[model samples]
Target: MAKPVADTFSPSENAAGYVSDDNPVLGFSHMHDSGTGGLPSLGNFPLFVHPGCPGDDFTRCAYSLTFRTTSRVPGSVTAAPGYFAVNLTNSVRAEMTATQHAVLYRFGFSGDEHVDVLRDLKRPDEVEKGVPYSPLVLVDLVDLMNSRSLGGILVSPETGRVMGEGRYLPSFGSGKYDAFFCADFKGAAIRKTGTFVGNDAAENPKILDGVGSGFHIPGGSAGAWLQFERPTNNSLLARVGVSFISIEQACENAEKEIADWHFERVESDARKQWREKLGVIEVDPTGVSEELQTTFWSGLYRTLLSPQNYTGENPLWNSTEPYFDSFYCIWDSFRAQHPLLTIIDPIAQTDMVRALLDIYRHEGKLPDCRMAFCKGFTQGGSNADVVIVDTFVKKLTAGIDWDTAYEAVVSDAEVEPPNWGLEGRGNLVSWHSLGYIPWDDTDLNGTGPMSRTISRGVEYAYEDFCIATLAEALGHAEDAAKYRRRGGNWRNYWNSDQRDVFQDPNDVTVQTDYTGFMQPRLVNGTFRYHNTRACSPVQEMHRCYYDTHLDTYEGSPWLYSFYVPQDMATLIQLMGGPAAFVDRLRFFHTSGIAYMGNEQGFLPVFQFHYAGRPGLSAYFVREYIPALFNASVNGIPGNDDCAMGAFSAFAMMGFFPVAGQDVYLLSTPFFPEVRIRARTEGKWSVIKVWGFDPEGKKKYIQRAKLNGRMYTKNWITHDFFLKGGTLELWVGEEEGTWGTKEADLPPSWPVEWADGGGVGLDDKF
Candidate 1:
C-alpha cells in the first residue's frame, strides 16, 4: 500500500519516516513506513515543486535535496485521516492523499507577479526580480537515507511523465529492495523536460542512469524534471503510482486507480475508506474531553496504518496469496496492534496471516520484522508465531491455510536459520537442553546477539506456549505437551536473591523490599549478577537495546520478571501470592522503573487482573491514560511503532488482550458505552456501563453481566465479540470484591515445571 509522506529533514538520525514539527520539508515521497524505529525508510523518488525560477531561468531552481529544502509555515500543517496539507515558506501550498498504490497531490501556487529568487537562494542580495507564474517539479531518484545504490530516471518529452526506479537498503533490515514509481502531471501544458546531475541541468537526453560506487551516490543529485507553463487556475495535480514490481505496473496502477486526475474525488474516496475501516468501533464521547476523545480515535487510526496491504505489489515470487508488507518489526506490534485488528478487522488480519505463511513458504522462516521485501533483524523470539497463533485462537479463518500456519510456527520452534540475527531463532539447542539462553551462550548452530539471555528466554517460552495452544487445538497432543513444558523455561532465569535498588538523578540510593528478579545464568548453572534496575528509567536507561550486552532488551530485570504471562498463577506464588504480587507490581509502576514507551510495559498494566485485583488494574489504566498518553502534539511517551496507539485503544475501551491467547482482561472504559461490530457475523458486541462517571472517579467494577446473566470472571473471550452480546458493568468509587476472588482470575497453565524437573499439576491459586 502507498503511504505518500513528507520527508522532513531532521537532525535526529532515528526520526523514522516523518516528524511533526521543528524540521524543514525535504520533499513529498510516494512511499514511507510510519511509526518505526531507526533510520528513515522508503522516502523514495521524492517530488519537489518550485513555483517558478527567477527570470524564468530553469537552472536557477534548486536541484539537490539539501538545496531544495524549505521551511514549513508555522501553524500551517494539517493532517486528517487520509489527507495531509502544509504551507511552505516558499509560498506554495501542498496537499496530498493516496489510494492503494498511487498518491494524488494538489499544489497551489501563490500567483505572485514577482518571484523571490534571492530568497530561494537564501541570499540577502536581490538579483533578477520578477517572472510570470509557472512551476517546475523534479523527481529525485534517492531515498530518505541517501541509500541509493543504483537508480534511473526518465522524463517523457511529449507527455511529461516521470518514471523512475531505485535500489536501496531497508531501514532496519538486511539486503536491498527496488522501488518503482510513475509520476504524471495535469493542469498545465508541458514547457520542457530534462535530466539533471548534481546542480547541472540539460534539455537533451531525457533519461539519466547512475550506478553508485557504494551504498550511496558517489557525490551529488540525479533526477528528472518537467517544467510547466503558467496554468490558468494557478494549480497543478500530480499523480504518482508506486510499486515494488516494475515501472509498467506502476503506470498501470496509476492509470487504473486515478485516471481522471480528480484531486477532490481521490481525497474524498480516501477519507471514505478510512472512515469505513475506523467505523467498526464506536464509543460514546458524550462525557469525555475532546483531548481524551482525540487520543482514543487517533490511537485507533494509527493501528490501521501499518502492516500495510501489499497484496499485488510483491515481486519476490509469483503467488496468489495476499502479500502484506511492512511488518515494521512485529516485536513491537504482536502484543496489541495485531490483537486489536483481530477484533475490529478480521478480514485484514486473515490476509496478514496468509501473507506471513506465504513469506515462510518462500523464505523458509517467519520474519520477526520485515519491510520493503527485506528481512529485518530479529529483536528477540520469533514473535510472528504470536501473531499467527493470535489469529488462530481468535478464529480468523476466512481464507487462512491453517495447516501451513501450523507448520510455520513449528519451524520457528524447531529450526535454526543460517543467520538467526535476521530471521528465525538462534541457540535453539541451548533453549531446549539448558532450559534457558545462557548469558555465555555458544550458539554454534546459528549466530545472533548472544545477550538478552533472560529476555529472550522468557519471550521464547511464551512464543512456544502460543504454539502449544494451536497444537492442542489441532489435536497434536504430543507436540502440545512438549511445548507446554518448554513454556516453563522462564523459571530458569528467576534468581531469588537478587535485590531491587536504584540510584536516582540526585545520586541518592533507594532500596526496596522486593527481592528476586530475572537474572542471567551461565551454562554451569550459576546465576550471573545483573543489577535489578539496570536498564530501567531510573538507571542506565540506554543500556538495553538491540545491540546491548545487557541481559534484557530495552527493559530491566525488574520489568521482565513480571513477564511470565503463560502461567501467572505460578508467578504470583513465586512473588509470595496475590497480595505480595500486587505490592511488587505497584512498586514497579510507581518507583519509576516501568516505562510505558516500550511494548513490554503494556501487559503489566493489566496484569493486576491475574493477581485477583481487577480494580487495581483499572486504577493503573487510568493512571497512564491521560498521564503518559494524551492528545498533545507529543502525545505518546516514546516511539509509537503502532503498538502505542493499540495500547491506548485497548486501554480506553476497558479491556486488554493477552496476545496469542483467548482472553481479554476487563477494566473501566473511558467511555460510557463501546460498540464493536464483528466483521464475521455482522453483529455488534456492546459494553455498556451503569453509574458511569464523566470525571473518571468511579473506576472499580462492582459487578458485571453478559447478556443478562451474572458474570464474575475479569476476562472475556473472542466468543463474546464473534457471537455479539452485551456486557454491562456497574462501577463505584470503592474497590469492589466483584473480580477479587481467586476463581475470577484469568486463565493460566495449571502445572508448574522447574528447570530440568518434571511438571507437577497444582490446582492451588
Candidate 2:
C-alpha cells in the first residue's frame, strides 16, 4: 500500500514530503515547499543510490524495485541548511548540496566493484517510457503542480553532459510555461552509458532533441543511467543546473554558478550564504535546549524557502527587474512572513514589491495564489494590496515605484476584471452597492465566489483600509477618503444577538461557543441564521447549513468576528467592551475555534493587547511555544504557507505584527536577548531586545524600558524600531495589568473616523 510520508528533515516537500524514522527511505527530491498546507507541489528531479542486485541493470531497473535504505543512524544523515546526506542499505552514500539555481550530488560506494546512480523520470499521465532523459538529465514537463505535462524535452549534447526544456500546467492555476535544465558529470569512473525501459536495457542513444522525444520510447518505465567503475577514492559527483527561461540559459547558469568540481568548497560557500541571511537576527541560546535551538533556527530556515527568486528566469518579455513566484496566496504570507522580512531582510521585501509591480506590468494585476509560471486562486481579497501597503506604511518602500503602484491599486479597486477567477475584484461593485455581500443574493449577482461572502467582506474591508492607508501616505486625500469609507464594510456583518458561552470559566476546557456573532446577511438587510455552533463538527455544520459553505477560508465566523482591526474600538463596543473582548479572545482557545496553526486567526492572540490585556496575550503566546510548534520535521503546525514561518519566528522573537499597520505588539520571548540589524530608508539600524526571565517562570511583561527611559505602552511602533535602540522588559508570572488603561493601548481606528462614511445596512438602503 502507498502510505503517506512525513518529511521531518526535508520540509521542502511541504506537507507530503516526510522521511520518517520508521519508514523506508524514498530518495530525496529537489524542489519542495517548506511547510505549505496544500498538496505537495514539487518533488521533481530526485537523486538516489542503488546497490548491485542479481540481474539488475543500472540503466533499466525501476527506482522502487531497488532495496530500501536502512534506518538512518545519528550522524548517518547530516542535513544542514543547504546540505543533505544519507547512506543506503547497499553501502552507497549520497550527499547533496545546492546553489541558488543549481545542485551538486556526490555519491560514494563502499564494498563494491561498481554501483548504480538512480533517477526515475515521471511525467503526468504518460507512460513511464514517455518521460525522457538524456545521458545528462530529464525535464519531466508533464510532471508539475499535481497536473499533467502539456509537453517537454530532454537533450544530450555530449558525453558527461545533458540538458532539457519542458512545459506543464499547475494544479491550481490557469496558465502554463516552460522550464529548462543542464547537468554535467565529474569525478565518476564511467564504464558505460545506457537506457532503461520496462526492465529492458539498451545502449546509449546520443540524442539532443529540445522539441522531440529525446530518448524515451512509447510505453512502460524508462530513464537514462550510467554504470560507474570503482573510483580512485570510491566516490563520484554530479552537478545539475536549473532555469525557467531556456536550455542555453540553464547551461549558462550552471557554468556561472559551479564551474569547478570543488564539492567541499561549494558546500562551505552555501553554508556561509545561509549564515549571512540567517544572521540578521541573533538570539542568545544560553538557557534553551538543543531542541529549542533547533526549533528556533529551523523555523527561521523555513521562512527563507519561498517567494523564490525567478529574476532571470521569466520566460516572458525580457527586463532587468527582478521576478519572483511561488506565492500560494498573499492571504497566507502577508500576515507575518513578509512583515518579518522588513525587520530581518528589508532589501528582499523591497525587491518583492518591485517584483509584484513587474508582475502587475505583465499580468495586468499583482499575483495572488501564483504557482510555477501561472496564476492560481484568490482566497480572500487582493491581499497583495495589504502586503504592499504594509511595507509602505513601515517606510520599507525604498526602491518601489509608488506612483505606478498607486495606479495599479486604484485599478484593482475601481475596475472589475472580466474573469473574476483570474484577476482583479469582480465583487467590488456589489460590495460598494450594498455595502456588504449578501449570502442569498449571490445567485442573483455576478460577483466573486459566494462560498465565503462574510469572510471576503471582512478581508475586503481590511484590504481597502490598506489601500486607503497607502493613498493617504502618498498624499492622495480624496482616494484615501473614498477607501476609508469602504474599509468600514465589515460592520455590516455584525449580528448583535449572537453571544459567546463560556461553559466553565474556571476550568481550562477546549470548548467555547460563539453562538451569537458575525452572521451572514440577506439582501433584505436581515441576518441569515444558522443553528450550528461555530465549533460544531464539520458534518453537523454542513448538515445544518443549506448550500452555503460554513467555514470561512480556514476559519469560523466567531473567529473572524474580532477581525475588525480597521476599527477595533467599535468592534470592542459591539462585543460589549474590553472585559468581554478579552473573554471572547479566550473563547477562541477554550472553544477550540482558534486557528492558531494558520494566519486567519493569528491576530486574535494579540487582540488581547488591544483589549487592555497584554498579559493574557503574552500568556497565550507563551503557551503556544511547546504545544503547537517544535524542531522536528512535523514541527510546523500547519501549512507554513507563505509567511507562516514568520509566525513562529515572531513568537520566538517576542512580538507579533498587526498587518497593514506599522506596529508590533509585545510579548515575552523565549530567549534572554534578541537582536536584529533592522534595515530602514537607506541605512542599517540595530534593534536590541532583552528579557530578564532567568528562572523562566516569568512569561508576562511586567514593565518595559525604551532607550533607558520608562516606556508605558505594550507595543512598539515601526518608527521606534526604525531608529533602533534598546528595549528592555521585566517579566513576571502574574498578569501585570499595567497596559490595560485606555491611554496605554495600541493605536486603533476610532469610531468617529467612520462617522462620515458609515456602512451599516441603514446607510445604503
The RMSD of every model to the true structure, in order and in angstroms, is: 2.6, 6.2
lDDT of 2 by residue, 512-626 (tens): 4443466777777777763224433321323212123653555667667878878888788777678877887786666555656667757787888888888887788766766
All models: lDDT? 0.87, 0.65
For candidate 1, write residues 343-449 as lDDT tens digits. 98888888899999999999999999998899999998999999999998898888888899899999999999989999888889988897888778788888888
Query: Against the true structure, candidate 2 has what lDDT?
Result: 0.65
Model 1 TM-score? Answer: 0.96
Find the candidate with the highest TM-score and give its number: 1
Per-candidate TM vs. native?
Answer: 0.96, 0.87
Error of 2 at 1 (Å): 34
